[model samples]
Target: MTVDVEDYFQVSAFEEHISRGSWDDLPCRVEQNVDRILEIFSDQGVKATFFYLGWVARRYPELVRRTRDEGHEIASHGWSHIRATEQTQEAFRQDVSRTKALLEDVTGDPVQGYRAASYSIGRNNLWALDVLQETGYRYSSSIYPIRHDLYGMPEAPRFAFYPVEGDLLEVPVTTLELAGQKFPCGGGGYFRLFPYHLSRWAIQRINQAEGQPAVFYFHPWEIDPDQPRQQNIGLKTRVRHYLNLKRTESRLKLLLKDFHWDRMDRVFLEPAPSP
Candidate 1:
């Protein structure tokens, strides 16, 4: 299991609704939401990877330290949450390096995993893998294998693979091909938008038929239905961002009981890769 540690306002969906300069002025709700998530995980006896935003970590070091104190893996979500496709190689390196340094300083552990904002690492910018390896990330769950307008390398491997030939493991978010169509089974808006049974069945199919564990992800903001509704976003963006917010926490609880979950490193990186 993994939670992207960012506030409701920090998401790429709200980029047009809010600016980076004004982020501090908005009510910072991530701490409360994450605290609730941590509580839920503790109740469920589950540990997870939290992909921390460098901007969030800087403002909420205590929150980052608390997650580490509770034994969750702390990983980088990049500084400012910029998309890899939007960043040049040097810019990407600087972002990851800075976030790694900050997260390591906060948690005092190696920040081994990364997931780009909006999963922006795609076919054209494959060089991001080399930058990740060069900067010392052990694994990345940044690619979505399904086709998407914003981000995906649809032709990428569904399971974990060595994108740079031995260093960083690229663990694409799980998906399943059924009825001659691909659907996203990995958690996010997809989890909320689709019936829980469909997700459950799809994940079961991947596990039983494909013999691979699915990597599920969600954000703390997802559980916060009462967060300020971002105004002025386009209808499509609004629905994708706001759909089923209240159900997220309960759905997550069911997911925790339904399948096995662990940090990205433990789930995909260790135990040796298949030949």
Candidate 2:
């Protein structure tokens, strides 16, 4: 899955320096990076679900059309890259509604799924699920089952399940408890930072041992090492966002070759309706 189809300046860490009002003046980095991704996927004949930021969609309607033309699923990544937990219920509702409207306008397809910025729907903010359902989203891939400083639901179910009174399907990032600690087998920086062999093994183990399909995610920025860098952010956040970026495309190609991957929607079918 993808999030925030935007230039590097839109990332959460750099939000202070970059304002959304001035997005048009900045370079079209996401467009170039996404082109590279498209070429890579074309080489392998792989299709994916791209969760687009409404901001990106409004700015680059052609990119959204091209993604659909090339056979990728179009979904919402909210209008701005703002975290749902940070917004009031009314604000979150509007954020999602506006994004969904904009994405549908560009793709001419109903956007049934969403992923929050930073995967921000957690224990306290899970009320966003009901908001999503009310706003017409049927599925969400926003929860991260593993614990993290920004977002995680450590005790949440590892696989897809219907939360109480909610119609949305929850698909957390794939992770495994190795020696009793959560490991990042699901990709992103973890895929680049760790030995490639280890990621391959972890995915194999998850599939063969547990019979669960692994969910992998990467962003356009992840592959754009030459993109402008954000300075003065905390070291850990910067590293998490930028480390191994230069090698991301190559590593993605290797991972694609090593594993049998399908769009997340294909692997996990729609959940049953509640009684």
Candidate 3:
């Protein structure tokens, strides 16, 4: 399991509605929400990778330290919340490099994983993978294999695979294929949009039937139903962001109990046995 450590206002869906310039002035609830998440994970005895934004780390170093102290993995979610597709290669490099350095400085540990903002590193900009490797990351969970209006690389593999001929791994979020169609089972809006039982069933199928581990993710804002709602967003964005907010924490508890979850590095970056 992974948690995207960003605040609700930083969400890409609200970029148009909420300007980055105004981020500092807005109230931040990420610390409190993450505290709740940490409590849940501790109670369940699960360790997860937290892909934190540099912005959040700079503002809440204690939160990062607390998460690291509790045995969770700290990874980068870029310096700000800019999508990889939106950045030039140099800019993307700077973002990841700076964020990685900042996180490592805060935790005094080597950061080994990255997740692109909004899963924006698709076919057109897969050079981001090379940049990640260049920056010393071992793996990334940045691709969602299913097609969607916002982001996806539908042609990408449904499980962990090297995007290029290199050691750096690209782990796509989980999806269930049926009748040759891929449907997202990974966490995010889909986790809230679908019935909890449906998600449970799909994950079970992926585990038992396909013999593959599922890569699940959700944001810190997801469980905060009372977060300040954005105004003037279209009905679609409104529903996608706000639907079933109350159910996320409860459902997440069920998911933790229902399956075995570990840090992304532990689950996917384990060193191969030497011959």
Candidate 4:
């Protein structure tokens, strides 16, 4: 139940091309969608974690306050949608720092966790983890243990494991190897693209068979059917984002009933030390 609080157009690669004006022109439904999510979770009596973007935190400060007041953990997702791997160490540090401060200002609570945009921390960007630790973050859910054009570290562990050199924890998104390929079970585009039962079964199998909890994530915009369509983007990005837009919310509600879900902090116990 780790929710990424960002608008659809705010994805990193498209940030340079998309303007703030574009956002104003865009249909705004994230707040409404989240209200619906709140209702669903309330009905189920579940509390979850929300990793909020500073941009979203600033504009929708009440939403942040409401989310925290409702017993959900509010964490940081950086100031802008900048990916950790693409920025210098200082730049990434500043982004996350600003995010932490802004979120705390809005919620009046400390934000101890983070999730990089697009799960962008990887082998070459291991330096980012050191920066994260120094910036007072206790854990990061930013690594994906699958190969992807945008982000992943294929050799990374599939569950919560502390890095030896830093205090920061690495809780990678859920991935399952199928047909000789590691597929992301992080439940974003993959969840929408695949059949509903397959996604549910994957998490169930992981939890029951492997004794590991599935870390699920989705953006506010993903479930918003009224979001604007981007122009001039590549075909894959469009399809990955905009496909089956209308079905996302209903499907997510259905998926919610199938599992015993909780925040990542509560679900992941600290790993045992190696010999």
Give the TM-scores of the predictions, in the order they appear: 0.97, 0.93, 0.98, 0.92
Give the better candidate number (1 or 2) by TM-score. 1
Candidate 3 clash total?
0
Q: Worst lDDT window (10 residues) for model 1?
A: 266-275
**Candidate 4, 1-275: lDDT as tens digits:** 88888877787656767876677676667788778788878887777889988888898999999999989989998877778877998899899999999988888887889999888888988888888899988889988989888888988888888864756788888987777677777688898898888888888888888888888988777877777677888887778888887888888888778787887666653343332
lDDT of 1 by residue, 184-233 (tens): 89999999999899989999999999999888899999999999987778
Clashing pairs in 1: none
| Local error of candidate 1 at residue 245 (angstroms) | 0.6
**Native-vs-model 3 lDDT?**
0.94
RMSD of 2: 2.0
lDDT (10s digit) by residue, model 3, range 1-275: 99999999999998999999999999999999999999999999999999999999999999999999999999999989999999999999999999999999999999999999999999999999999999899899898888899899888989888887678888899999999889999989999998899999999999999988899999989999999988889999999999999999999999999999999888887762111
Error of 2 at 141 (Å): 0.8
Rank order by TM-score, top first? 3, 1, 2, 4
RMSD for all candidates, in order, please.
1.1, 2.0, 1.5, 2.2
What's the residue-level lDDT of 7 in candidate 1?
90
Instruction: Quantify how close model 3 is to the true structure by its C-alpha RMSD in Å.
Output: 1.5
Better of 3 and 4 by TM-score: 3
Report, for every candidate in turn, its global Cα lDDT versus the true structure.
0.89, 0.81, 0.94, 0.82
Pick the TM-score winner: 3
List ranges where model 4 is wrong by over 4 Å: 20-27, 178-180, 269-275
Give the worst 10-residue stretch by lDDT in candidate 3: 266-275
Q: After superposition, how far is residue 147 of candidate 3 from its true place, in Å?
A: 0.8
Order of candidate numbers by lDDT, starting with the best: 3, 1, 4, 2
